[model samples]
Target: MSRVFVKKASYDNLDQLIAEIFTLYDINLRGKRVLIKPNMLGAFPPEHGNCTDPRLVAAVVREVRKQTDRIWVGDNPMRVQAGGGVDDSARISGIYEASQGYYVNVGAKARVISIGSEIIAQMPVSEYFLEADAIINLPKAKTHMIAGITCCVKNMFGAVVGSAKAKIHYDAGHAKRFTQFLVDLYKYFKPTLNIVEALTIMEGDGPTHGKIREGGKIIAGTSGVEVDAVVASMMGFQLNRLKFLQLASQAGLGECDLGKIEVVGDFEPWPNFELPSTYSGRPMDNIQVAQAAEIHEVWGQVGRLHPRFIEENCTACGSCAEICPAGAIALDPYPVVDEAKCVSCFCCAEVCPEAALVMPKEEAQTLFLRLNPQIREG
Candidate 1:
């Protein structure tokens, strides 16, 4: 059984928190190549809770550096422009300064190499990630509009660099199929540890577009799926509902069953947090398909779906491209989703920081019917 160490901590002092985390996980950073992958989803501020807190990451760096001088940190931001590249080295330096340590963008400095054969293009990645001896994944725990939740596994997607990421989503296009891609990625880059930041989790249309909840919790584990399974349980959701988690488990990557895992530290239930109505619109299910059809109809009308982009609000960041595992989106003049390619995953809409993208109520209703075809009966 994998061991997961969870602790209740406040932001006032992160040094003590970092020490407790390292001790519980039994991580020896001294003289080890430590690659810290932060959830820098975008160039958003810490207050927004859209990305991993730099302060938290800095604390991790300080502790790890004590064990070794070889500390590398970085992540592939959704849509990074030339000047504002994915590295965002400044933010990294700021955190290290606070902790009395320094860091660098490992991805930027390190060379990119191909992983496996490219389904669409040549020179696909996995090598740069594999080069690291020890990897520390820092993922922000948040509700996802699709795939249920974005925790450790989803964070690994950023390991794929450049336009190659966009190309993969174009190839896969379906949630189930895209999930297979995630499993493949996980198999390629298995991290030594996963540390989840649930101090402030997002809900509703999230992984990006959601209200923040003060979960005030941190979970660390050797098994990535083990950590996410616990996060899902805290949210009162089943592990089965999370497609990535299920895929990971099926691939023999990690365990999602809470009953089989050992959790240390504060193991009490979460403070009964609730997902916002916008995100929790379809909880009703029935044993019979015919009976379930009734629930689908109500949900269909309420949860319509057609991608809507508010031009004024859009930054054209192309996060939608990165999260679209199906590779449906292309960053043309603006973001465009090939309907034939879109699987209604809404990962694009979910990761939009400006709330620039939206799904129309009517279209969502139609999608709901298609997803639950039996409910289309008159």
Candidate 2:
């Protein structure tokens, strides 16, 4: 059975708590090239709850230092602009300082590898990630627009370098395919250890752009899939609703069934934890279908389905136009989408810092019912 350890912690006591966890998990890093991967999603500050807490990163780095001095801490954030890279993101999130002078710009160098997924045949991955003897995955406990919740398993997507992430979203075309791609990627490059920063988590709608809540917990395990299973339960998300977790479990990646796993210490599910606006906690046999219907392909027959831009929230930063793989968006003083050229990838929505670009969920249940004639609304 997979084992997960949960502890209620604070930044003041994190270093001691992490050292204890490392010992309990028996994570050995002596004389090894170790890469510490943290959730540096963008240039957002820690208080925003977008990236992993810098204090958590610092604690992990110190523990790793006890065994090995050869350590690198980094992640490839979504490229919102032309010149912005991992260094800018790391510094802004205070991860560079917290890394204790071990931060490396992972996006600077990459090596191409064969992914062999249905979405893409080959892709670029970070050289630092590939050269590591062991990878310590540090993911924030947060809601994601696409994956419902991005914890241990979804965090591995940072292994892909630069704009290739947007391209992968474009190739996958919708939520179901994209989720499958995530499972495939995780299986290929599974981390040696998984640790989640649940002390502060994002809700409402995230990975970015969500309200912060006090989770007051840290979860750790060797299996990313199993760790994510525990996180989903803590957030009050039905295991069936997260398709990627189900797929990962089916692929024999780890035991996703909570009953089958071993849980250690002070685990209590949060009461009334808010989920993403896109998810309604409805009952459905095909959860992937529900996700696709709500987020990506609303007007299936009509080809005009695209992201709705919130003009007031936009900064005219041109991030949407820059990240569009199809070049479908143009800045006419403000952004405008050319319906015919748009691929409905939602890459624009993902890269929008201000939450300006969003999927339409005004009448989600009605629209989903209309689009899927066979599947009845819950």
Candidate 3:
């Protein structure tokens, strides 16, 4: 039977809490190369509830460092500096400071290794990760705009690095295919442990865009599939609906059945929150639709991206430009977004604190309806 631990603790008591978690899992770190993969989607602060909590990562790293000689922690951030530099190490370093453990950037330390042609042909994964004796996946439990939810399995996608992620998105248009890709990734490199930051879950359009919903808990398991299944269930989703869990189960990666799994500590259920139905209002053929027409159709008729510029909240920080994967947003006169280029990923909207970026309800509903008309209008 698969075992999962659920604990509630603040940063002050995190060290002890982590120890208890590892103890429950019977994890041994002595002389092991432990790699911690946290959700560093971008440099968003912890309070935003977009990325993994530094405290959780720090606590785990600290605990592992105590028992292990080697520890490396980092994630391949989405945005990269020119000449292929992914610099989010400093942010993670700040987390390690609290725990008094050293933080190292796996990106710079990464040595490219062959990933075999099962997932995405040939790709390079961090040598630190590849060479590690134990990998602890630390993922934030949040709703995702693309793959529905980003949990333990989805977090490893960061390991792919560079344009490979975007290319995967383009190659796997359907959610099922993307889920399959994640399963393939897990098959390629299995983690020694799976830990999820469910204390502060994000609702609505997430993984990035969403509202922070705190649950006050932490989950740890040896099986990524079982941990992900628990995380998904906590978010009011079925295991089967989560394509990654389904794919993983089919692949014989791990057990997805909760009834057959063992649970430890408090297993509290959370209130049901509304999540953004998948935006399906527009046709996939953006090539046919002009930028202006697409924007007008989505905003005017369908109503998708109701871009707003709140001068009061707007810091004009140019974060929108940097986060826009499509280069749809350009900073000049307070950030102009080329609707044609925008993939509606909502990276800018999530990063913006000024509440400057906005999407209307009608547009959201219509878009979701367009994409998922089968959701059944109730």
Q: Give each model a TM-score.
A: 0.79, 0.91, 0.78
Can you give the lDDT of residue 96 in candidate 2? 99
Local error of candidate 3 at residue 136 (angstroms): 1.3
* Best candidate (score: lDDT): 2
Q: Write the per-residue lDDT of candidate 3 for residues 324-367, one digit (tens) a residue.
A: 65777778768888887665555566556455775444455455
Model 3 regions lying over 4 Å from their true place = 82-89, 99-101, 109-114, 117-119, 279-361, 367-378
- The full ranking of all candidates by lDDT, starting with the best, is 2, 1, 3
* Model 1, global lDDT: 0.65
How many clashing pairs per prediction, in order? 10, 0, 9
lDDT of 1 by residue, 1-378 (tens): 788887887766777887877887788767777788877766566788878877788778878887887767777654553224554533632333433444544345334554452333333443446677888898998876545677888888877764455446546544455666776776678788888888888865566667788878888888888888888778766565566777788878878888888888876656544442323434342111221213323443544344677778977776666666666677875788776656555556655767877755334433444545444354
- Alpha carbon lDDT at 215, candidate 3: 71
Error of 2 at 131 (Å): 0.5
Clashing pairs in 2: none
Task: Provide the overall lDDT of each model, using Cα atoms, as 2-decimal numbers.
Answer: 0.65, 0.81, 0.65
Give the residue spans of candidate 2 off by over 4 A: 80-83, 281-289, 292-305, 369-373, 376-378
Candidate RMSDs in order: 5.5, 3.1, 6.6
Candidates 2 and 3, the one with greater lDDT? 2
- lDDT by residue (3-67, candidate 2, tens digit) is 99999988789988998889998988999999999999888777878899999999999999999
